[model samples]
Target: MPDPSLMEQLRADLTTARKDRDKLRTTTLSTFLSEVKNREIEQGRAVSDDDVRGLLTTAIKRRREASEQMRAGSRAELAEKEDQEAALLQAYLPPALGEDEVVAMIRDAVAGGASDVGGVMKAVMPHTRGRFDGKELNRLVREALAG
Candidate 1:
C-alpha cells in the first residue's frame, strides 16, 4: 500500500482519538477533516498537504481570536475551551519559527537593503511563509528596522 498522506494520517489520528475517548481531539480533527473535504469538493482537486496546513492554520487563528474575545467578555470557561481546541489543532501544524530564527531572518532582510517596513516585510514573508504568523513577523521587522 502507498504511504498515507497527511490527510490520511489525520484521519487515522481522529480514529485513535475516538478510541481513546478524547472528545476535544476527536471533535477538532473531525471538523477539520470535514472542512478539508469540503474544500476539495469545491475546488474539484485533491487537496495537497500545504493546502490542508493552510486550513489548519486558519482554524487555529480563528480559535485564538475566539478565545481572546471570550476572555474579554468574561466567559472564562468558553475561552478555555477555545484555547484547548486551538492547541489541539496546532498539533498538526508545522512547528512555528522560533523568535531568534525570525529575528535572524528579519536582520538578513534588513541587511539586504530592505530598510522600510513594507520592503522588509515583502522580503521576509516569502522566507517565513507557512512557518510564522504575519503579524508577529511584522512586529519583529518593525523592531529590527527601528533599532
Candidate 2:
C-alpha cells in the first residue's frame, strides 16, 4: 500500500479539484479513486502503490486515445478538453522517463535478445508504467527495434 500520507494527498487534491470547478479533472479523479477502491475490495487488501499507479496509467491511456480520436474526427475542442484532462491526470504520476532513458532501456533489452516487439515491450514496460504512456513507449520501442 502507498503510505497513508500519499493517499491523504490524493484526497486533498480531489477536494481541490472539485472546489476549483474543474469538472473533467474532478470526474476523472473520482472515477480513479472509485476504481482503486473496487480493486482493493476485490483483493481484500489495501491497494498498493503499484496498483494505484497502474490504474492511473490505464486512465491516462484511455484519455490519450480519446484525444487522438477527437482530433482525427475534426473535434478540436473535444481534443483540447481531453488533453487538459490528461494533463490533470498526469499531475499524480511520477516523472516521465526521457527519450534518452527510454532508448537506453530499449537498447539493454535488445542486447538481451529482446529483438521482437513483444519481447522488447515486456522487458521495458515495467520501468515506465505509470510514468509513461504505453502506446507512446511502444512506438519508441518499435523504432528502436527497426534501427
Candidate 3:
C-alpha cells in the first residue's frame, strides 16, 4: 500500500482544490481519488505507491489522448480544458526527465544491449519508474535507434 502520508497529501490537495473554487482541478483530483478508491474496493486491498503512480500515468495518458482528439475535432475549448487538467494532474507526479537526460539514458540503455526497441524500453523503464511518459520515451528511443 502507498504510504499513509501520500494518501494524506492527495486528500490535502483535494481540499485545497475545492477551497480554491477551481472546478476543473477539483473534479480532476476527485476523479483520481475515486479511481483509487474503486480499485481498493474491487481488489479488497489498498493500492501500493507504485500502483497509484501507475494509475496516475494511465489517467494522464487518457487525458492526453482525449486532448489530441478534441484538438483534431476543433474543440479548442475542450482541448484547452483537458490540457489544463493534464498539467494539474502532472503536478502530483514525479518530475519528468528532460530531453537531454532522456537521450543520455537511452544511450546507456543501448550500451546495455538495447539494440531493439523493446529491449531499450525494458532497460530504461525501471529507471524512469514514476517519472516521464512511456509514449514520449518510446518516440525518443525510436528516434535514437533510427539515427
Per-residue lDDT, model 2, residue 130, is 80
* Backbone clashes, candidate 3: 0
- Pairs clashing within candidate 2: none
Tell me how far the alpha carbon of residue 56 in candidate 1 is from the true structure, in angstroms, after superposition.
1.3
Using TM-score as the measure, name the better of candidate 1 and candidate 3.
1
Residue-wise C-alpha lDDT for candidate 3, range 67-123, written one tens digit per residue: 999999999999989888888878877898887888899999998877999999999
User: What pairs collide in candidate 3?
Assistant: none
- For residues 13-50, write the lDDT of model 2, one tens digit per residue: 88998999988878877887898889989999998777
- TM values, all candidates: 0.85, 0.77, 0.83
Between prediction 1 and prediction 2, the one with superior lDDT is: 1
**Which regions of candidate 2 are displaced past 4 Å?**
1-6, 19-22, 113-115
Best by TM-score: 1
Clashing residue pairs, candidate 1? none
The TM-score-based order of candidates, best leading, equals 1, 3, 2
Q: Which stretches of candidate 1 lie over 4 Å from their true place?
A: 1-4, 113-115
